[model samples]
Target: MSSQCPDADNANATPATEQWTSISKHVVNSYLEANNALLAAMGFSSTAEDAPTTESAVDTTTPSPTAEIAFGDENWVMERSTDDYDTLGVGDYVRFSKPIADTDVSAFARVSGDTNRLHLESDFAEDTQFGGQIAHGTLVAGTISAALARLPGVTVYLSQDLEFTGPVRIGETVTAECEIVEELGGDRYRLHTTVIGGDDETVIDGEAVVIINELPGK
Candidate 1:
């Protein structure tokens, strides 16, 4: 539903016109509330406070480096390859494994000062929202990058966009995989990476735009 607020262009209308505009807005708001209830019954997750559509007028936000990684393609697959590892292309994947343990979590929290109970204490976390301990998202992201470094030719990671979908519990081994999605320029490749648990559940998914000095194993 569209906002029924008075148009800013017509702000100089007469007082009675303004009053009618206010009433129109009130009627529109009530109509929206009723429509939202109907939508909620159909499993819509958004509330009325969230505008159905909006365009930010101020364009001061920095663009995500990973945003263009998937821009022009529709058939892109991010899975690891059994295809020759030696002939890695702009969209090939490599995998590495790591264990999610308390030692790693604790060390991460200590170094980062992110003592959130869900990552620090098993008991506190159990009583809280998550119901159990979970690995730190940053740690998972960092570990993926760390694994990538082992392949060689990595000069710098220009940026990363990480999203944690599910929890990574202690002792669950996760394999970090990076799929070369596209080449941005010379020695700069956009990689779609993921960290999945032993059971094949995704723990952390991210895209990293990495700048490598040379091809790996070169």
Candidate 2:
């Protein structure tokens, strides 16, 4: 019976490992160069590392940090819209559209203290009726708040009713729109509140009563 020398085995393995490491680095560099060229050809002005974040890419006219967060994506027209309920007619409405990033759900969980396994864990969610992780019904409902912020006046939510009709996957852009369905008289109004899923389907629909207080000194 015989046994190989440990030092001899290590010596043989070193060159193979080093050779593969060198090859891997070359392949990576080639990929990076190719990617940069394609990005340049497609009008990508900055490399991914140098690209501006959604938060920084926006113009400086935003009114608040929250508004800046809501307007994270400029591709959506609603991101640039102003809050003005005075000009709203019965059929008119405003929408706030933004994609639900992975960070959003995690942040919601941390802030809300709603660490529902269905909303955070994939393995557990796969067994649920939802079949996979779906955004919290309440978190998705936050879109309603984003929309109402766009309305004129000091908007206050007196009450709201939500009927969750579908699940929204993270990263899917959802648009929350509020329409003046009926004027409740005085400074109050009845609104048709809804959230349109990224798939262009209605995932949430309900009604809300709000007080649109007039601006101060005006």
Alpha carbon lDDT of each predicted model:
0.63, 0.69
**Could you say which candidate leads in lDDT?**
2
lDDT of 1 by residue, 66-143 (tens): 423322113222234534434556756677776766666755654565656466545555765668778877777766
Q: Residue 100 deviation, candidate 2, in Å? A: 1.2
Give the clash count for model 2: 3
lDDT of 1: 0.63
Which pairs of residues collide in model 1?
A: 91-180
lDDT of 2 by residue, 1-218 (tens): 01222232332233434534544564566556666655544445435565667986843442333322332335454642345556654766778887876666766665566656566556555766878778878888888987877676678999999999989987888999998888878878898999999889999999999888876666
Q: After superposition, how far is residue 61 of candidate 1 from its true place, in Å?
A: 57
* Pairs that clash in candidate 2: 83-150, 84-152, 85-152
Q: What TM-score does prediction 2 earn?
A: 0.63
